[model samples]
Structure formats: C-alpha cells, structure tokens
Target: MAKDFSDGIKLSQPRPYLTRMMLFLALVGFLLLILAPRIMDAFLANPGLNGLIVGTLFIGMLYAFRQVLQLGPEVKWVNAFRRADPGLALPPAPQLLAPMATMLGNRKGRMTLSAGSMRAMLDSIGSRLDEQREISRYMIGLLIFLGLLGTFWGLLITVSSVGDTLQSLNVEATDSASVFTSLREGLQAPLRGMGTAFSSSLFGLTGSLILGFLDLQAGQAQNRFYNELEEWLSTVTNVIDVPATAGENTTPEQASLLALAGQIAALTEQLHAEQRLVRELAENQAAIRPALEELAGSLKKRGS
Candidate 1:
C-alpha cells in the first residue's frame, strides 16, 4: 500500500511552469475584478455598452483568478510530496546528460544508466501524481466560487436597479423624457445582471464538472501505478531475503525455520546498510497517504 501510494504521488507532480503561470494569471485576473466596478464607472461613462463590457470582463477575470488560486496550492502540495521521497531522483537536463554519460562511462556506464533511469522514472511519476491531485482540487473549488460570485453580483445589480426605477416612478410628474430614461436605466441593470449571473454560473459549473471527471481519471491512473510499484518493491525486498541452500539431510521444518531466520537477518542487515532509508520510507508513506486521502475526499465533496 505504501509503495502504491508513493507511485501515485510520483505520477501526480505538477508541470514545471504550467501551474505557476496559471496561478499568476488567475491572481492578476482577480485583482482586475476587485477594481472592476470603479474602473467601469470612471473610464466607461457610457453605461449601456461599456457597462456590459466591464461586467463581462469582471466576471471572466474572477472565474479565471479563482482557478489560478486553486492551482497554486495544488502545485505546492505536489512539490512538497516530491521532496518527501529521498529515493526518487529527478532527471538531469539533456545538456547534463552528455557529461554524465562521459563520466559514468569511465567506470560502470551501464550500471549508472540503469540506476539513473530507475531513479528518474520514479521521480517523474511521483511528481506527476502529486500534481494531479492539486489540479483536481483547484478546478473544483474555483468553479464553485466563480458561480457564487456571479450570482451575488447579479443580485446586487438587480436590487439596485429595481430600487432606482421605483424611486424615479414615485417622483412628482417630472419631465417625461427624464422619467422614461431613468426607467430604462433601471431595467437595463437587472437585465444585464441576469445575463452575467446565468452565463458565468453556467461556465463555471461546466468547467467544474469537466475537471472533476478528469480528476477521477487521474486518481485511477495513480492507483494503478501505485499497485505496480508496490508489487515491484515487494519483489525486490523479498529478493534480498532469498536464503542459501541447506544440506539435503535437513528436515523440511528445520529448513523452513532457517530460511525464515535468514530472511529476517537479511532484512535487518539491509536496513542497517541503508541507514535511515527504511524509517524514512515508512515516514514518507505515512505523511503522504493521509494527505492524498484528504484531497480525494475534498474533491468528492466539491463534485457533489
């Protein structure tokens, strides 16, 4: 189970800069949204077309910003997971590969390549697995937030516009043109507000649903990879415990007990040789599983 979890973690790691860039864009989008109303009021004096454009931009930016924020945390989580597994080794850049090959070839090139490839594979897998969880969670939360924000903004506009229309109607017989103008303005607010609310919510919900499905797929992949890793690791560990043959005269029971004892002894020696490797692996697995489970739960809840 531990090995399986580790493999899942490996496969989930975030992309090099994709996550970061998304996060940055999201943040900028959010900031623009925060100042959207003021900016619209000041720069866009034309309330009809300009107001619609500003509202659209604001809602779009808010949706995008929320998504980015969610992604940032996910990337951080993946990076942390990668750091926990000491056994995993990230691959060197292509430029470094040539020098590494030259140096390794001087001694045991094949052995070096084998070890390096194994390590690199583990690292890459772990990183990607970690990232998958992060992206999944971000998308879910982002969609929900975007939907709520749009709804709230829409309501505000609707209420405000309705109040203005009522107030204008209550006024003494004023200029017919001015009264009609006020009524039109009031009507426009609710109409525009409704459009923003429904459209943004629809987009946000759709995005969330799509991403949620992808997250599930990623989780399944992670689980499969983890199972394979566990099987391989178990085989390797067991190989280290293979016992030497005893004399033919030895009883089957005696041979079995001896083998068991030998295996135990080998495990102890292996643990000692690797210093804290066993303990670290155990600790890393412990830390990762709970977090992964938590993330899975969170994703499920969000999807629901």
Candidate 2:
C-alpha cells in the first residue's frame, strides 16, 4: 500500500516552456501594439511623457529579447537530453574522451586537437558575441529608419500646409485676415512636422544609446566567462604523464585512475572558485538589497 511519489508532480518539457514564454511575450507585444495609439496620444498630452514611454518600452523589449537569447541554448540542451533517451532514467551523455585520449597518446594529434579545439571554442564564442552585436546594430538601424519615416511624414504635412496657405492667399486677394489665417495654417503643418521628426529621432537615438550600453555590458560579461572557460580548458589540456607504479607495467586502470584524479583535482579547483564567486555575489546582494529597497521606497514616496 505504498504511495507512489511520482504521480503528484508532472515535469514540464523545456521546449514547451520556452515556446509558451515566447508566445506569451508575442501576445503581450501584440496587445501593446493595439494600444500604442492611445498610449502615444496620452504621452502627447503630457510633457516628457513620450521620453519615458519610449525609453521604458525599448529597454524592456531589448531586455526580454536578450533573456530569450541567453536562455535559448539552455533550452536546446535540455530538450536534446530529453529527446536523447525517453526513459528519463538514462545515464547522462558521455563526454568525448576518445579525442582527449588520442591527443594525450599522440604528440602530434595532441597538438593538433588542442589547437583545433581551442580555435573552435574561440570561434564559437566569437560567433555568438558577434550575433549579439549584430542584433544591437540592426535594432539601432531600425530605430533610425523609423525616425526617418517620421521625418518624411512630418515634411509631407509641412508641404501640404504651405501649399494650402499659398492657394488661400492667391484666392483671397492679399487681405490681412486671409494672410494671417493662411500663415497660421502653414505654421501648424511645420510645427506638427517638427514635433514628429524630433520625437521619433529622440526615441531612436535613445534606444540606440541604451541598447548600445547594454550590449557593451553584456559583451564584457561574456568575455569574462569566455576567459574563465579558456583558462579552465587550458588547465585541463595541460595534463602530463604521471609516473608509473613501481614494479609493474602501466596498466590501463592505473592510467585511467591518474587521469581521473587529475580531472577531479581540476574540477575541485573550479568548484572552489565558483563557490567563492557565488559567496561573493550573495554577500554583495545582501549588502545591495537594502540600499536598493531604500532607494525604491524613496522613489515610490516621491512618485506618490
């Protein structure tokens, strides 16, 4: 009459979770688009409102997309693992030790494989980093395009208004009242056009600046990670032959044990470093949380 513990909880697949999140975001974006006109109108009614709205939306969208990109590989890895063995009780995927072993045994292969793997790793990292940069660049370009579109629309309005003023002046025979009215209409068009041009340009520039800053920060973080990974790989690849056991030929068991021991030592070092980093991060969070909360409270009070 033992109860099965597995029935109460069902595990969700990574792919579905990712898809759901992406879909949810898309839906939200669509909703935002639908309300954009009203939102724009509201902003137009208030001073500095457009800046806040545009900045917040651009930053939020960039952050969300960046998060998706960051999580994408993890999701893929998880889905790969799930698809690899359906039983869910399968052993973890084996590491490709053959290449490492071949490299260790053959000096030439060792050099070749080491160099190749290092190059491949570097290239992969560089490609991903480049993709991030490209995305940021494209976003900047899009912003600029939108700004130009706004400028064109504004210019069109200005031109139409000027034409109407001219026609009215011609028809009204140079009366002072007609001139003033026509002039006012002409001014309205240019004024509206200028506002559109300036607002769009401001949003575009602000988006580019914010995204550029975020991209730089992300690049720095990624580079730091890459450096750490490279160091770890270098350490791993520097494995040397351990002295053979006394009075016996070097058996496979002994060699494997030595290699494993070396690997364990390396892993231990890495774990210690990671643990220290985590501890420092936790400590920093602990220290910063209070200050952050206080700042938030002060801002809230001011806003209220």
Candidate 3:
C-alpha cells in the first residue's frame, strides 16, 4: 500500500466515520461544556477538576477520530476489489488489512483459497479490528468512573465540613453580629461542595454520552468495511477438487497431472468470476512455472 500526501493531510478513503450532524452536535456540546462552567461559576466551583475531565474527553474524541481515519484503507481495498480493478493502487495499509496484504503478496500471485485459510484470514482481521477499537471502550468507562469519583468526593467533603461547623457553633454567644458572621462563613463550604458535586457529574455524564455515541458510529463503520470485504472475497474465491475421473481408479503416475488439473480448474473459475483476475495471473506465472516444470519432468520419467 502506498501513502499519498497531496497536501499536508494524508489522502484516504472513507474519511472520518462520523457524520456531519454528529460532528456539529459534538462540537456544540463541547463548547457548551467549556464555556458554561465559566459563566456559571457558582455551579462549577472546582474549575480545575472539570477542566481535567473535559481535556480527557477531548483526547479520547481525538483518538477515536484518528482510528476512524486509519480504517479508511481497509474500506478502500474492499471497494477496489469489488470494482475489479487489478491495476488500482492501495492507500497505506491499515492494521486489519496489513497481514492480508502480506499473505497475498508473499504468495507471489500464486494465491491459495481454501476454506480453512479463508477462515483464518477473517479471524485475523476480526482480531485486529477488536484491538483497534478497544481504546474507545476504555475511554467511555474512564469518563463514567471520573464522574462517580467526583460526585462522591464532593459529598464527603460537604458532609465533613458541615459536621465541623456544627461542632464549632457558638450559639450561646450574646453578640448577634458574631453569630451571623459565623453562620455565613459556615455555609460557604457546603455551597462549594455542592458546586463541585454537580459540575463534575454534568461534565462526566455528558462526556460519556458523547463518546459512547461516537464509538457506536465507529463500530458501524468497521462492520460495514468488514461486510464489504467478506462480500468481495466471496465473489472472487474459487474452490476446486479432483474430478471423479481422478478418483480411486486413478494411478500414482497420474497424481501430478490431477493436481495440475485441479489448479487450472480453480484458476478458470476465478477468471469467470472476475475478468481482471486473469491479469493478476501474470504476476503468478513465475511462481507457478516451477511446479508445472516438476510435474512435466515426472510425466516424462513415467513415460520413459
């Protein structure tokens, strides 16, 4: 796979799995989360904690978007295959597709397509896809955990402060001015605690919702890509077996010939499936030539 840099941005197919509506809503929500805290200072008493959660959410979103872009090449590869473009160049190979490309390329055009091999290939692709998406799942869980932590921490501080204020109460003091002042000062701690509690929960829950939705979108994109790849493979793959003529009656001398016949039959089926597949056979000619030469030598020895 080749990387393209027409501009500063790398060119890739299936750009940004997120839709325009999703992007707009997420941007608006983020802006509100950032700005609302400053405007409603009373509600968001602990700006520092809120800021940390917001920053973490931003990092998670960015990471998800990056993964979305990385998945582009796999989608593109499936599209190219479906279009029957043997000459089409690929973009930078994605993790899910890298092993597949390596397998095909290593075959030197003499590719094998057995049911077991196909299952293994699909399993490898699925594993890579799971690994790629695992981070988003962790990020969602982290956001929720942060929210709960903030909520409980704030409540504990509030409860402790209220208890201390009750213990320090000078209710029997004669000075009314001193009493009022002490009461007002005592209330401040609880108010601050309330602010911390509400603000953290707001940001944490909001961030979790936003990221969860985005994760769903990314998962859908991945599933679509996987489906397309499966479809493409189904169309191109051909499995041939030794014919009845080469059954129990076939002599040992004919074994090599039967193998050659089976290979040709498979290739013929491949050509029927996609005209462009024939062009690809040219690259495999050298790879297959040695096998053919060996078979021919065996035939001559038997005849002699």
Q: 1-304, model 3: which lDDT tens digit per residue?
A: 2111111222235445667426766687688788874646733577788787888889888877776776766666644533433434556455667777765543323234555566777889988878878998999998888888888878988998898888888999999999889988997897778778877888888889888777777787777667656654544455555565736657776887888889999999887878777666876897899999999999999999
Candidate 3 — what's its lDDT? 0.71
Per-residue accuracy of model 2 over 1-304 as CA lDDT, tens digit each: 2222222222222343335546655775687599888657644632353555366547645663563446344333323432332223433322222232232332321122244565566576556656656766666666666656666766777687777766666554658787677677667766766676666665656555555555555555445444644553454343335576653667888878878889999999999999999999999999999999999999999999
Model 2 misplaced regions, further than 4 Å = 1-60, 63-113, 171-175, 239-304
Positional deviation of residue 39's Cα in model 1 after best superposition, in angstroms: 27
Which prediction has more favorable lDDT, 1 or 3? 3
- Off-target runs (Cα >4 Å) in candidate 3 are 1-16, 21-44, 78-92, 106-112, 239-304
> Which numbered prediction scores highest in TM-score against the true structure?
3
lDDT of each: 0.53, 0.55, 0.71
Window of ten residues with lowest summed lDDT in model 1: 104-113
TM per prediction? 0.38, 0.45, 0.66
**What lDDT, from 0 to 1, does candidate 1 have?**
0.53
lDDT of 1 at 288: 100
